[model samples]
Each structure stands twice: as structure tokens, then as C-alpha cells.
Target: MRKRTVGTGILVACAVGLLVYLAFNVRLAPIPNAVAALKTVGMTCGSCAGKIEKALKPMKGVAGVEVDVKGGWVLVGYDTNSANPETFAGAVRKAGFQSWLMEQMSLADFRRVTGRDFGAKVVRSGGCGTGGCDSGGCGNAI
Candidate 1:
């Protein structure tokens, strides 16, 4: 009789714990102070942008993602402590797209040149072959 009462109490406690876990939403702190601008190859359209975002969005400490199809570049805003230019570049590589890091700049410079916050806008234009390198072969991807 006592064992049954104890087991019932344990089950109720577990149920309550599970409910609390389901009810609370996990919050990730945004790290938005630095930007990693990378030059990409073989990225030709908005679909390419989506792929890049998919690769980068789940990375820890990444705050924002922006892709410029017209320019063949991807800009990632992230927390310096948790991610760096290499983290973004490596993820793109794993996603099967190659990337060359252009520069890592401060959020101020990024906003100044882009005129907006990361993920707030994207530059999608230019024809394929012109999209990533080969604008008469842009720098030969060197």
C-alpha cells in the first residue's frame, strides 16, 4: 500500500516536470556585433541564399544572415565569442558551396554600407554566371 502511494507521487512529479519543460520556450541570446562578409562561388540565386541561411542559422551565436546574390556574397552577423569568420565560411563549405572570406567588419561598418540591419534586406539581382565570379571571371575566384 505504501509502495503504491510512493510510486503515484513519483509519477505525478515527473508529469509536472514534463509539462513545465513543454511550456517554456528556449531563448537564445543574439550576438550582433560583428559581420563576416564572404565571397562565394556557384551561388546563383535566391535558392542559393536559402541554402546558405540553412547552414548558418543554426550555428551557435549567429545573430543574422544576409545574402547578396547579385554580388555573390553572404554576410553573417554573429557573436565574436561563439563564432568567427571561419565558422561561417566552414558552414558554407559543408553546405556544398565554397566561400572565400572577404572581410570581418564591425556592425557599424556593416550597417553603413548595407543601410540596414542583417537579415532585414537582401540583394537579389544579376544574371547567372554573372552571379558568382565570371563577370568576365571576377578575380578568377582567387
Candidate 2:
């Protein structure tokens, strides 16, 4: 009957609208023009990711933060005008996580070199030699 057709049409319209909303919200976030990829360590769970995010999100020029818990990366999008990677490293330290700036470059280069899934091959700061770290030399410079 006409009532059934009207109901079906309304259901279809709602489904399409829901899909559109998800398409925007679920899509990968756009990387900022200037990004710093920090090879993160000691971040084991979602709570750890939240700690890192809380540390970086309030920074002066930090634009975005993407934490890959499994991949062990903390991708921080920041403005070069008022932000430096050094401050970011400090924040991570305060949050009880170890992070070192692996690369500071354009979005294109970052995109080319890394992915959100496997950021395993990144170079660590490792301020100490193979002898082992003395203080916090493992994450930041000694």
C-alpha cells in the first residue's frame, strides 16, 4: 500500500544520511602541513594513548594528534610558526611515555615514509650506547 512505500522511502533516506555522516567522521584525518613523527615507547594501551594526547593537545601550536597504540607512533601535527619538536618531546616525557622525534618534514614526505599501521623501522634517539641508558637518555638527548 501507499503507507508501506512511504515508510520504506523514509528508511532508505535515513540510511543514506547515516552513511554520509559516517563517511566524514570515519575517514582518516588529514595530516597537517607540518608534522612530527615521534617513535613512541612504553605506551601499552588506550589509556596510554589518552595520556599522550592530553599532553600534546594543549601545546601552543599543536594542531592534531594521532596515536597508534599498536604501531607505537605519536604523530603530532603542529604549526612551525609557534611550535618546536623539543617542547613536544618534553610533553611526552611528562606524560610518562618515551618519545623521540623521528622526523620533522612536510606532510608529503611524512606520508611517503610512514603509515599509521606499521611505524616499526623508525630510528630512536638512544642517547646512550649499547651499554644501556643512565637516566632518561633513552628517549631524549642525554
Candidate 3:
């Protein structure tokens, strides 16, 4: 009976030690900075948006990318240290579409292009539309 008790105690102690070690060693991966969003022209259909998203998705530092055909915007999440706004634009251009890093366009413009506002809140936040308007004149300048 004493031997069984000792064995059980040892097992319990080992389990507690394992739990503590795991607790100390386990770490969550750092969340990467997202690219936020970039407004561009020439995205007129779901397939167009898909092409843009596919192009940007594999670039270094890109965590997530969403291209809205109706909204004419590409919302991207990226690791800023690994990529930047320029890189994102380049990716879109490489995909055969003209792209630029324009500020978030007006809700009216977004609606006109995309037909919906998945990124309307970002526009409302007022950080968008700060960049220069693109050649297509979908920005605040007009």
C-alpha cells in the first residue's frame, strides 16, 4: 500500500511539473500589422478583385488581403516590417491592373464603385482620402 502511494505521488508531481513547463514555454505568435486598405481603380468585377487578392496574398509580409470590386478598394493586412504600401501597390500592378495608394475614398465614391461598403468604417474613421487621389479621380479632390 505504501509503495502504491509513493508511485501515485510521483505521478502527480510529474504531471504538475509538465504542466508548469508547458505553461512557461508556450507562447502565442505575435500578431502581424495589417496593411489596412488601399484604394485603386480598374477593379470592376469579382474576378478582377480575385486576381488582385491572389497577387498580393503571396507577397512577403502580407497576412490577409481583400479586394472589393464594387468598392474599388483592396484591404490588406500585412507585417509592416516586411512590406509597405508601395509594395502592395506594386503587387496589384504586377497583376495587370493599375494601382495606387490613395487614401480611403468617400463613401459615395466607394458605393459608386463597389456597390457596397465593406470598408465604409475605415473611410468614416477619416484616415483614408489623406493620400493623393489616383488618376481616375475617385478621390476627394473632385
Candidate 4:
């Protein structure tokens, strides 16, 4: 009985040590940028929003993503220097949607008006009439 108890204690200690080692060694990737917003088109339903969110969330440098179907926008939080904004538009395009960077003030004001919370930093923006672009504009300046 004494030997069996000592063996169990050793096993438990080993398991605990392994868990602590793994926890300390595991390194999570850092988030790349602050919050950013992109005006999107063709996201008329929940599925569309989900598809876009799925595509963008896994991208490197992207920390978090929120898709607003009603507002037709996607807000992202990331590290600016590491994040490639073009990748965001590309993901949207791949998901069969169109997207563009909304002007800083325009996005902030829109968020305020719509009562959306993203806490974005406004990395870049397209001017007036640039929101919700289609294939003709190709997610760029017209």
C-alpha cells in the first residue's frame, strides 16, 4: 500500500510539472494592429457575415473581427505595422463581397450613429462615395 501511494504521488507530480512546462513554453501570437473598419457590400445575410468573419479572423496580424450585417461593415482589431489591409479586402472579395476602407471620421461617426462598438484607430479610409463598392471599383479608389 505504501509503495502504491508513493507511485501515484510521483505520477501526479510529473503530470503537474508537464502541464506547467507546457503552459510556460506555449507562446501565443501577438496581435498586430488596432481596430480598423471596412465598408462592405453583398453581405445581406447572417451567412454572408459569418463567411467573411471566418475568412478574416484566421489571418495573421488580425486580433478580432466583427461583421455588422445591417451596417454593411467589418470592424477589425490588429497590429497596424504587421497587418496588410489589402489582405482584408482580398478576404472579403474571396467571400464574394466587396469592401473598402471608410474615411476615418466617416467610420467613427458612423459607428457612433449606429452605436457599434469596435474601438478602432482608423488606419486608412476611402473618401465620399467610396463605401460599399462593387466589381467596377474593385475595392479601390474610383
Candidate 5:
């Protein structure tokens, strides 16, 4: 009677809520006006870049991370209020690589010298037959 009506109403509300949740896409909002550029030394291959990315991407306030293996540069977009360039540099160092701030003038000069845009997005996700070799040169981890 009354109990059955209340249960039916609750079930309908739950079904409507589930529909709404499944119909919409949820994502994190991007940060505006914050980009950190780091000159990373010792990135010899894509795996190196992947390791660096894996270290920095989980940090708080990091919106996006882009690595340029050929240019030895890492660009990180984040919220300026919660993160800074120094944090990224430290992460790179912790991952066993030296890093430094690429000043505006230096960045421009590097771009000119390399004749390639440094800001291009990097794709470091593992692919078929992509892996690094050990010091003994046993073999690549393909």
C-alpha cells in the first residue's frame, strides 16, 4: 500500500540518477595560463621520457605533461596557484636526470638551433617493439 508506493518512487529515482551518470562524460578541467618548460638531460629514448612522465604526471595540480625526446625538453601544464616549475625540475632530478629552466631567450635559441618546434605534443605511451636495453646490452625489452 503506502510502503509499496514509497519503494517504487525510490527505485524510479535511482534509475533516473543512473541514466544521468551514464549519459555524461566526466573529466578534469584544464588549467589556464600555466606552462613549465624544463631542459632534461639524459633522455635517450622514448622509455626515458615515459619514465619521466610517469613520475611527474601524478603530482598535484599537473594538468598535462608533454615530452620532446629529440629536443630534451619537457613541458608541463598545471595550475600555477598549486604548482610551480621547481616542482617539475625536482621530479626530473629524482628520476635520475638533470634538469634546468629553459629561459625565454634560451628556448628561442634552442628552437632556432634545432629547427623544430619544441612545443609539439609527445606520444610516449608504450607501443609494439618499444623498450630500452640494459647496460650489459643483453637485449631490448621488446
Candidate 6:
């Protein structure tokens, strides 16, 4: 009788442990697919980036926000089910910054404004006329 009771208690303990393990290991739903990038204009300094980041950070469904001062762009990652690009654009405009959907801008214009070179450099050692490059290399200034 004693051996049977001990065996039954061990079985119950094992069952409870398995249930707990399964509960913790179960996978949840996948994250939504509403991520997008926005290009902001008229941002001249780091302070401008801070203002834009602060404005968008509090909005719902915003997963992440990055402001590139040199690139004059704001990249936003969001959940489409909860928020849309139009809403995000509105938030940027309200902060006194000009913003447009990244898709609207032409690739050529983006490269020009950001000062990014897509092709080989004509001068290997010399910097661009815009003073973006120096002895250290190309600075982040755009």
C-alpha cells in the first residue's frame, strides 16, 4: 500500500511538471507586417532628429524610430494593423518638419540630398567639393 501511494504521488508530480513546461514553451502569434521608411526634409541638426523621435515615440503601434541627421530621413517601424503611414506622416508634419513617404521620392534625389555615392569615386584621395570628406574620411554631414 505504501509503495503504491508513493508511485501515484510521483506520477502526479511528473504530470504537473510537464504541464508547466508546455505552458511556457508554447509559441504566440507572429508580429504584424506594417514596417515602412519615411524621408524627412528641412532637418539640419541633431536637435531636429530629437524632436521628430520624441513626437513619434509616444504614438501607438510604433515599434522603433530612427532619425538620420546626415541623411535627412526618419525610418519608422510600425504595426500596420494598429497604425498607418498617413498617420505617421501627419505626426511628423505636426512637429514642424516636412515629411514624405519614402516611396514618393526618386532614388536620384535621395542620393543627391544624402551625399551618398553609388558609383566609383573619380578622385581616390581627394574629398568632394562640398567639404564632406577630409583627411579622416567622409564625415556624416549631408
Indicate whether candidate 1 or candidate 2 has the larger lDDT: 1
lDDT of 5 at 87: 78
Better of 4 and 5 by TM-score: 5
The alpha-carbon RMSD values of the candidates against the true structure, listed in the order shown, are 6.6, 9.1, 12.7, 9.3, 6.4, 11.2
Compared with the true structure, model 4 gives a TM-score of: 0.54
Q: Distance (Å) between predicted and true CA of 63, model 6?
A: 0.8
lDDT, candidate 4, 48-119, per-residue tens:
666777888778777667777667888776666677766787887877778887633333454666576454
Model 4 deviation from the true structure expressed as Cα RMSD, one decimal place: 9.3
Show pairs that collide, candidate 4.
Answer: 32-78, 32-79, 33-78, 33-79, 33-80
lDDT of 3 by residue, 1-142 (tens): 9999999999999999999999998653323444456777765445555667678877766656666655677776556566666778888877766778865333355456658653333321212243332443323221
Note the residue pairs that clash in candidate 3.
Answer: 34-78, 35-77, 35-78, 70-113, 70-114, 71-114, 103-129, 104-128, 104-129
What's the true lDDT of residue 43 in model 4?
62
Cα deviation of 113, candidate 3, in Å: 20
Q: Runs in model 3 with CA error above 4 Å? A: 1-30, 103-142
**Reference-based lDDT, residue 106, model 5:** 35
**lDDT scores in order:** 0.76, 0.70, 0.61, 0.66, 0.67, 0.61
Per residue, candidate 2 scores C-alpha lDDT tens digits across 52-136 of 8889987877878888766788888877777887788779988887788887877667666666422334323323333323443
Which residue runs does candidate 6 get wrong by more than 4 Å?
A: 1-32, 104-142
Per-residue lDDT value at 55 in model 2: 90
Clashing pairs in 6: none
TM-score of each: 0.68, 0.56, 0.49, 0.54, 0.58, 0.49
- lDDT tens digits, residue span 1-142, model 6: 9999999999999999999998998644323244456777766555556667788867876755667656666766556667666777778888877787764223355356547432222112122343534543333422
Candidate 5 lDDT trough over 10 residues, lowest sum: 133-142
Task: Estimate, for each residue in 1-142, the C-alpha lDDT of model 5 and write its tens digit.
Answer: 9999999999999999998887785545456345677898766666777778888887877777787766678877667666666778888888877887664223345456656443454545333232244552213212
**lDDT, candidate 4, at 137:** 36
lDDT minimum window of 10 residues, candidate 6:
118-127
